[model samples]
Target: MAVVLEVDSVDDPRIDDFRDLKAADRRPDRPGGKGLVIAEGTVVVRRMLDSPFRPHALLGVDKRWQDLAPELAAVEVPFYRASAEVMAEVVGFHLNRGVLAVAHRPPERDFDEVVADATTVAVLEGVNDHENLGSMFRNAAGLGVDAILFGDRCADPLYRRSVRVSMGHALRVPFARVPDWPGGLGLLRRRGFQVVALTPDPMAPTLATALTGDRVALLLGAEGPGLTEEAMTAADVGARIPMSAGTDSLNVATAAAMAFYERVRAS
Candidate 1:
C-alpha cells in the first residue's frame, strides 16, 4: 500500500529528486546520468510503475494522483502530492502531464543475451536523435522485432524525451549496445545472423527480395548521410525500401517501422 502525502511547498525535500531535471541529468551520475529513469505524464508514469524501473517516489497534482491511484496500490513508494505551480517551480517548467515518477536504472543486459533467441533485430549507427531512437523502439515493439542493438553514436533511449516519444514502449522493448565499430558486427554474423545493410541506393535490391535469412539484422544509419561506405561494404547484402522516385527517404524510425512491418506482415 502507498500513502499519498500532500506537499505544498516548492522546496519540499521529499520531492528534491524531481528538481532541476536538466541540471541533474549532467551531475556526474552513472547509468542514465540523472541517477534516475524519469517518467513524465500519466501514461509514462503508469508504464514506469509497471516496468522493471520501479518508482521510489512521485510528484504530481491532485488530479493526476487520483488517476494513478489504482496503479500506485502495488507500489510501495510515497506519492508526493503538489500543485502544478509548485511542480513547475521545482522542475523549471510547466509540465502539462502534471505528474512525474523516477526510478534507478536497472543493470544492463549483455548484447549476447539480448539476441540469444532473436529472429529479427535492428542495428543502429549514429542515430543520435532521441525521438527517432524512441520511435524506433515503439515500432519494434508493435511489429515484433526481437530486440534492438546500438552500434555507435546512438542517443540514450532512457532519456526523458526518448521515453515520452516512445509512448512507454521504450520501457518494454529490449536493447543492448555492441562493442567496436564494424568489427562488432561480426559477432552477429558468427551467431548466424544475416547482416543486411539498409540503404537508399536504388542499385540495391528491394527489402522484399534481399532479406532471405531466418535470423536477420537490419543495419541502419542516421537519416542524412545514410550508411557509410565502410558499413555498406561490411554487410552480407544491401537492401532498400521501395520508394517514389523523387520523394526523400523516410525518417530513420519510420523506415525501421516499415522494415519491421515487412518482417511480420504475413504472420
Candidate 2:
C-alpha cells in the first residue's frame, strides 16, 4: 500500500524528481538524459499507474490524493502531499492539475516487436514539436492505430509536454524507432506492409484510394515541408486528403488523424 506523507517544505529532496521541472538542463524527464516519464493531472497519473512505466513517487494536493486513493491502494510508492503553493514553488510553475507522478522510463521495444501484430501503423519523420507528437499519439490511440514508428528527426514522444498533451496515451501506445531513415522502411515492406506516404500534392491519389492494403503503414512528415522526395519514393504510394482549393495544408497531427480516421472508416 502507498504511504501518504505531508510535505511542508518546497526543498524536500525526497520529492526531488518533481522539482525544477521547467529547468531544461536539470529536469529528470529529458530524453537522452535521466529519461524519467512525468505524468501530470489525475487522468494521466492514473494511466501512468496502469502503464509499464512504474511510478516511483507522486506529488499532489490532498484532494488529488483522495481522488486517487482507489488507484493507489495497491501501489507501494510514496505520495508526497503538499499545498498547491508549495507544488508550484517546487515545480517552478503554477500547475493547476494539482497532481504529478514521476516514473522511470522502461526499455524501448524493437521495431519488429512493436509491429509484430499491428495492422495499422503511423510512421513519423521530422516531427520535432512535442505538442504535435503528443496529439498524434492521442489521435492514434483514439483511431485504433496499432503502433507508431519514428523515422528521422522526430521529437521524444515521452517529453513532458507531449505526454501531457497525449493525455497519457503516449505511455499506453506501442512505439519504436526505425533505425535508418527511409532505408529502414524496407523492413516494413518486406514484412508485408503497404507503406503509404501522406503528402500535400494534389497529383497523388486520395487516401481512400491509396490505402487499400490489409496491413498499412502511413508515413507523415512535418507540416510545412511535408514528406521528403526520398521518403515518397520509398513508399509504395503517395496519398493525400481531399481538401478545398487554396488551403495550405493541415497540421501534422491533424493530417495524421484524418488518415487514421480513413483507415477506421474503411475497416
Candidate 3:
C-alpha cells in the first residue's frame, strides 16, 4: 500500500518533483527540464496510476487523497499530503484540479508493438500543438481507434498539458513514433493497412467512401499546413470531411475526431 506523508512546508525536498513545474516539466532538451510526465487532477492522476508510466510520487490535498485512497491501496509510492495553498506554492500556480502525480518518462513503445494488433490507428505529422494532440488521443480512445503513430515534427503527446487536456487518455492510449518520416508509412502499407490522408481538398473523396480497408491508418497534419504533399502522396487515398462553404478546414483535432468517428461508424 502507498504511504501517506504529511507535507506542511512548501520547501519539503520530498515533494520537489511537484515544484516549479512550469520550468521543470519543459522538454527534456531544455535547461532545468526533466521531461517527467506529470498528471494533474483526480481523473488524470487515476489514469496515470493505471497506466504503464508508473508514478513515483503523488502530491495533493487531504480531500483529494481520500478520493484516491481506494485506487492507491495497491500502489507503493509516497502520497504527499498538503494544503491547497502549499500545493499552489509548490507547483508555481494555482492548480484548481487539487491533485498531482509525477512519473519518469518510460521508454517509447516500438512501432511494431503499437500497430501489431491495431485494426485502426491515427498517424500524425507536424501536429505540434499540445492541446490538439491531447484531444486527438481522447477522441481516439473514445471512438475505438487502436493506437497513435507519430510522424515528422509532432509534439510529445505525453507533455503535461497534453495529458491534462486528454483527460488522461494520453496515458491509456498506446502510441509510438513512426520512423523515417513519409517513408516509414510504407511499413503500415506493407502490413496491409490502407493509409488514408485527411485533406481539405474538394477533389478528394469523402472519408466515408475512401476508408474501405479491413485495417486502416488515418493520417493527419498540422492545422494551417495540413499534411505535407509528400505525406499525401504516400497515402493510399486522400479523403476529406464534408464542410460548409465558408470553412476551408477544421482544427486538426476536430477533423481527427470526425475521421475517427467515421471509422467507428463503419465498424
Most lDDT-accurate candidate: 2
Best-first order by lDDT: 2, 3, 1
Please report the candidate that would top TM-score against the real structure.
2
Ranking of all candidate structures by their TM-score, best first: 2, 3, 1
Show pairs that collide, candidate 1: none
TM-score of 1: 0.95
Worst 10 residues of 2 by lDDT: 24-33
Candidate 2 lDDT by residue in tens digits, 4-73: 9999998889998898889889888887668889999999999999999899999999999999999999
- CA lDDT of 266 in candidate 1? 85
Poorly placed runs, candidate 2 (over 4 Å):
none
Badly placed stretches (over 4 Å) of model 3 are 24-32
> Residue 107 in model 2: shift from native, Å?
1.6
Q: lDDT (CA) for every model shown?
A: 0.86, 0.93, 0.90
Reference-based lDDT, residue 208, model 1: 93
User: Residue 159, candidate 3: how far off, in angstroms?
Assistant: 0.9
lDDT (Cα, tens digit) per residue for candidate 1, span 1-267:
779898988878888778887565452122545556788899988887777788888889999988988888887998998888999998888899999887777887799999999999999999999899989988998899999998878898887888889888778888998878878889999999999999988999999988888999999999998887777887999999999998989999999988898788889
Q: In candidate 3, what are the lDDT values of residues 1-267, reduced to their tens digit?
A: 989999999999998877787654444322247768889999999999989889999999999999999999999999999999999998888999999999988778999999999999999999999899999999999999999999999988888899999999999899999989999999999999999999888899999899999999999999998889899999999998998889668888999999999988845
Candidate 3: worst 10 consecutive residues by lDDT? 23-32
